[model samples]
Target: MTVTVADCERVQTSWFQLRSQVLGSGSWEDDGLTWANGDLMFPRVIDPAALARGVERARSEGASIVGAWLGLDVDPRPLAAAGFKKGWAPWWMAGPIDLGLPADPRVELRKDAPGADGRPPRAWFAAARQGGQAAGGAWAHLVDDLAGVFDVEVPEPFQRRGLGTGLMQAVCAAAASAGARQVVLNSTPAGYALYRRCGLQRIGTGITWWLHLPS
Candidate 1:
């Protein structure tokens, strides 16, 4: 199945909502913008009007810094007019899980189990271990048939050792095991090639806007 940019955005929003719930933060929508307050304040905007409202809301909430995810179709002139600067541009990627990718023998994959309290897990985490030490990790949130992958990281010391591919493969395996039809993630420049090797394609480019509000 082909995933469009809209699908990618919806999956991204779902990931943010799941993160907010897990962190005990708040997520809401107002004036066509989706807002989330967590380690960082994020307002997903679709247009200039919503962008303006998000800026005001962030400032009123005393947010020292606000980040906005804008689809590539969004006009940048408005963001510049509002004093928001361009942040990193990440590719929105989605694809079927390539279970054929070979997992690194040195990296053992672990998935989070249900807590002792027995509350069903809202999100699944996949961590890669090398010689019983933490090598890399990532999180996957399932919303219906779509799974959103977040924070796929491999430390500098762990780089160039295929830990990232192992993590991606592990994530895909977990998502597939949980019945997800597709996996999606925003890929940074550094991780772009790895994700491609894992079978994801760049469906769209997403813009992240940043603004520092007065204290």
Candidate 2:
């Protein structure tokens, strides 16, 4: 089945729910459809009219206005004209198959336990180099049958070592273990190639907006 913007929204909603659980804030749907995750993240506003309302509310409350329009092919210049900075424009990818973990013993995968201070459970897959230093790490949140991957990063020295592939495999394993049936994520321009290599197919487009970088 072709994934649509609604599917992307489901992934985003699940992600923010997990984030809010960890951060002690809950997300609410504003203007009937936009999802706002408190002040921690921007509201997902699509309709220009709704976006205007959300923007005004954000400005009035001194909260950063940042959000995304997924799969909608809307021109973001209007939002840019409204004083929001256009951030990473990502391609939404989803795949049904789980690319299994790598057999290489040089890298290890570990699922970090929840913090003692009441943070919710999150999947942290660290790819350790042969020398024991981490080459990279990826974090994910699995809600029901959907998993949203985020913060996949590798240091410059670790590039070209296939650490990213290992991280993707580990993340898929963790998500499947948690009963996820499909994996969804917004990929960076650099990550697009990596994710495609790992069996995920690009399904849609996503763009984010920000008011100001917090100090």
Candidate 3:
């Protein structure tokens, strides 16, 4: 199964839920914090006033907007012209097989077997030994249609090892177990080819937008 344009709205909404609950708390719950992980962290229905207020709170508390991401359905130029810089434009891709091993994923990290109900739990794998120590890992999530990834860096000295591939396989297996259709992520140029080699493709471009608060 592939992700469609209609999925954009859902993806954006889901991102909000994740950013909210994961970073701190959300408006959905009454007990959320006064200082929130606002629209800046991820693509959100931007309310300028709410955002300004949030930023002020963060600054007063000695916090800053670390990063921002949002999935788009229309051309991103309009957004960029509005005062945001292009961070990344990754394709949201999907594959036919969600479970089972890829043709040759190589090496094992930790395997989270699929749940009894026919869903695989999220998993990760890595390989890149120091003196035979693992260097890097790749992983994915299984949150409904919002399934996605996590990437980690291997210490500089451990570069060029296949730890990255192992993590890719780990997430794929987990997605398969979870019965999810697609996995999405924001990619930098360096890893684009590796993802393609792993059977992941670019479907739609994702962009991040930011506006400097008038200081």
lDDT of 1 at 31: 68
Kindly report which residue stretches of model 1 are placed more than 4 angstroms away from their true locations once superposed. 38-53, 56-62, 102-122
Q: Which tens-of-lDDT digit does each residue in 2-67 have in candidate 3? A: 566345435444555645655664323222212234544333355445444555554554444423
Tens-digit per-residue lDDT, 1-215, candidate 2: 46555676676677776666666554556555454454313333345676666666545545554565444455566567666676777788888637765655655667778788976555656564746776777776776577778778888898888888777777777777778777778887888888888888987776666666242
lDDT of 1 by residue, 1-215 (tens): 77877777777777877666666655767666677762122334356776677667667756688777776666667668777789998788999855478666755555566767985554677777776788888887777778888899888887888888877777777777777888888988888898888888998887887777877
Q: Best TM-score goes to which candidate?
A: 1
Using Cα atoms with residue i matched to residue i, what is each candidate's TM-score against the true structure? Answer: 0.82, 0.73, 0.64
Task: Assess candidate 2 and give its TM-score to the true structure.
Answer: 0.73
Q: Against the unseen true structure, what C-alpha lDDT does each candidate score? A: 0.74, 0.66, 0.53
Model 1, poorest ten-residue lDDT window? 37-46
**Better by lDDT, candidate 3 or 2:** 2
Model 2 error, position 74 (Å): 5.0
- Which segments of candidate 3 are over 4 A away from where they belong? 5-45, 60-62, 71-86, 97-130, 211-215
